[model samples]
Target: MSYIQQSFSVQFEYKVFFTEKIFDTANTDFANFLESRAEKGIRKKLLFIVDDGVTKHHDYLQDQITAYFENIDGFELIQDIIVVPGGEASKNDLQLFYWLVNTLDQHAIDRHSYVVGIGGGSVLDLVGYVAAVSHRGVKHIRIPTTVLSQNDSGVGVKNGINYHGKKNFLGTFAPPAAVFNDATFLATLDERDWRSGMVEAVKVALIKDAGFFDWMESHAGLLTQADPASLQYLIRRCAELHMAHIGGAGDPFESGSSRPLDFGHWSAHKLEQLTDFELRHGEAVSIGIALDSVYSWLTGMLDADSLDRIIKLLKELRLPLYHPLLEIEDDQSAIVAGLEEFREHLGGQLTISLLRAIGKGQEVHSIDLAILRKAVNMLRDKW
Candidate 1:
């Protein structure tokens, strides 16, 4: 047998910028952001994909994008602004992906050209996938509009859509060329959208930063009132924590099974599917967080005060602590099925992250089924 040993390394760098009214031509930020990647005097072509929900809020957004790029020296905007369904609906349909690739191919969107996604996390995920797979990879920029996207998912290096009723069943590890969090876009969100995204802030704080959790506890009332200053800080701090974990954890790609960032995601993902995605991602995570906190208490891994604090914060934020689907069981499938699927997704022994304390997470290889069931019942009874 003949053997050839080979190895190589490549470095990737991108920036997450915070701004407002990015498409306003007077704002030099978007122009400069685009120009940074351009060759001397060369115009970079861009295809803009937006979420319909965003367009509904900012009716002039499509026009603004075209006008802004027209005035910019180093960028050209494609006339078409493709608007897709918002939320999980965007990721659930694979046909949308094929259409995006076809559009890119038709327009000759090469590796050097850009595909920009402006929307919530799901839209960004779908668009990122399309960009990554086109001509190996086109430079992709993410303008994450929602609190969840701005804070967590949009800033990360992962992109995916659900498949076979599984969360992120198909995806990639392609980071965006840049990320822009426009605080202005968040202003018009309905109550559900506004409140749902903040749970991610809670999730990250519970597992990684007790200080952050304490801060959230104190500002819960302000946050509930949709105080812009408080919400902006919430997004920035959560993004900072998430970025630190991705940069420092050395497992950005989930190359190992221990997904510490996904502390309560096993049941969260399953709950979303069981509800047929009627539940928003953050809403599901809120319930999952409550469930895991209770489980941790049942196992004596976390103290009661911390658990109470967690539940109290969730309630204050208007997030639900329990869902009926969570306790449902069928002959062939149950919410517990998520555990096995999650284990298989990570590809090795099961690793479930539980709270050891408010700011600390502990990973376990096995869970006591009876205790978990009891915890669910406890949550059901209380709610």
Candidate 2:
């Protein structure tokens, strides 16, 4: 071999700012961030791609963004802030992806310019992917508007879209330049979105923070009612845990099969697709958590008492623990196929995160089908 050694390291750092009404001129967080990134002589362009759902609720959003950026010193906001349909449907539309990319091309959104995605996780995922592939990677900013996005997907480095009905089948690991989580946007979410959004916090607590889980147990009523303080705490704590796992765990890009953060996501991803995305991501994960928790108990990893508490908390949170499609009819069943699909996604072994205790997660390479069937039966009948 005549090749010489090649080695280098890249450092990635971004802040997740918690704010309310980010575009309000009184709130300088958004402007301050832009000013910090401003170059001496270059007028950086900012292109905002918003979620339609957000615009529908915050009717003054477009005007607010325009007026807010007018005072920014070194940045020029794209006059036409594009609005696209939100939710999983956005990710599944290949035409939508290309349309956004074409829009970027038409606007000449180079790498120097920034693409801001303001919406839920799905919209952000699509926007991030568009930014990543456009001009070989443009700087992108995230203003996550929902609990699910703010606390989980938006803070992370991964950006993806669905392909052929598979969840995140096509995606990239492109870190955002910054993430701004505006708590104000969460207030407009409908009841289902509000309730289902808290499941990630519950999921993270079950696998990593027993104390957090206890707190949720005590404040289940407040959380269920969407108490502002309680929900804020949940979002902050969940985001912190997810960020810690991403940065501190030494696997920000997930190079291995051991994904402890995905404690209950194996079946969750499948359930979302199987339900044609009728089930919210968090709702699917709630059911997945219940299934895996029951499976853990059946396999003698988690105690019965711990299992009870987990199920009780999920119920108190008003999240679903069962879905019709979750049934495992046989080896050919759709949901069961998720196991292999998940393994394929991970790419080496069939690593699944199962609970061993309230705050502890253990990864296993194999699962017994019969036991899983029993667990499913128990959830459908016993719960």
Candidate 3:
């Protein structure tokens, strides 16, 4: 928790800026929050869920809360640890889910209780959904420490685990009461995880901010190194794009009509399922954006330069152009099959979002598979 150098808090009703810090006095923000919870006589167990990767942490910033403020007298702290292998494996079957519910039930987690999620997307996604449906809902806060979580996963109020070879196959729209960000945690991101997150940031730029994309292109090398200034800018910028969509949308879940916040996700989610979640979510989106751009071109919606530059820009970010895991016996047929899942994901329509130009996109129906195959072939050769 770096000293929130400014009085860092933003009220959406007042105004929203990309760089607004949600916590002013961050140093005391967390501690005072718990103290308030305690002072109000909020009881039941406060469970913190940690997977193996996080539990193996030689150092955790949150330890400060427990070590220094554990005796604030809010209620008893009930910490239960789940040693997940980390990453997508932790989002597996219903059994792991049952284990968490059982843990909460055994500990007697009540409506008055709260669960704090303190890891990457999978941990927060799983725990948040669990708390939401637990006894029909429980209080929870997200302290998103990873770039992927902070930039994309952390803001939205949806939580669920993958099911039956699908990513986020089960979910509900559940927003957090509070979210804490510690850019300090980004220091520990592995090269792979860090780069994986940049894909979403890049996607946001391509969709919403061309100037930001130009800035990223001009500073690709420096950006890749995890510089504090660049990382902070990106985390804040990406979060804003996600927040804007969620804020403006009529429906949080995909029902009736889907939201454009999905942008590249139609392909990204199915790609994750098609590739078995082996590729990172950011990576999948990068590739999906590329795929969508080509579909746009094929439909005569996007021009050539926009299409080429889109592919080249993603290349600059180091996301995979294609994965060996997505190998298709016939590129054309595989894409048709791939498109099938995307259509189904959006409620059985061929409604597709394709780029008309940079920062310009449109959702239309009935894309041609022949053009889709060419796009697949173009990307497939790169892998």
Residue-wise lDDT of candidate 1 within 1-383, one digit each (tens)?
Answer: 99999999778889999999999888888788776677985667899999998999999998888788777776678899999989898899999989989999988888888999999999999999999988989989999999889999999999988887788889899989999999999998888988999998998998899999999999999999999999999999999999999888888777888788888889998898888889989999999999999999999999999999999999999999898888844423478888898899888999999999988989999988888888888889986
Count clashes in each candidate, considering only residues at least 3 apart in sequence or on different chains: 0, 0, 2
Model 2: worst 10 consecutive residues (lDDT sum): 326-335
Candidate 3, 50-84: lDDT as tens digits: 64555565245345445644544656676444444
Who is ahead in lDDT, 2 or 3? Answer: 2
Which of the numbered candidates is closest to the native, going by highest lDDT? 2
lDDT at residue 18 of model 3 (Cα atoms): 29
Best by TM-score, which number?
A: 2
Query: What residue pairs clash in candidate 2, if any at all?
Result: none
Q: Give per-model CA RMSD.
A: 1.4, 0.7, 8.1
Compose the digit string of candidate 2's lDDT tens values, residues 215-259. 999999999889999999999999999999999998888998779
Rank all candidate structures by their TM-score, best first, as comma-separated numbers: 2, 1, 3
C-alpha lDDT of residue 15 in model 1: 92
What C-alpha lDDT values do all the predictions have? Answer: 0.90, 0.94, 0.71
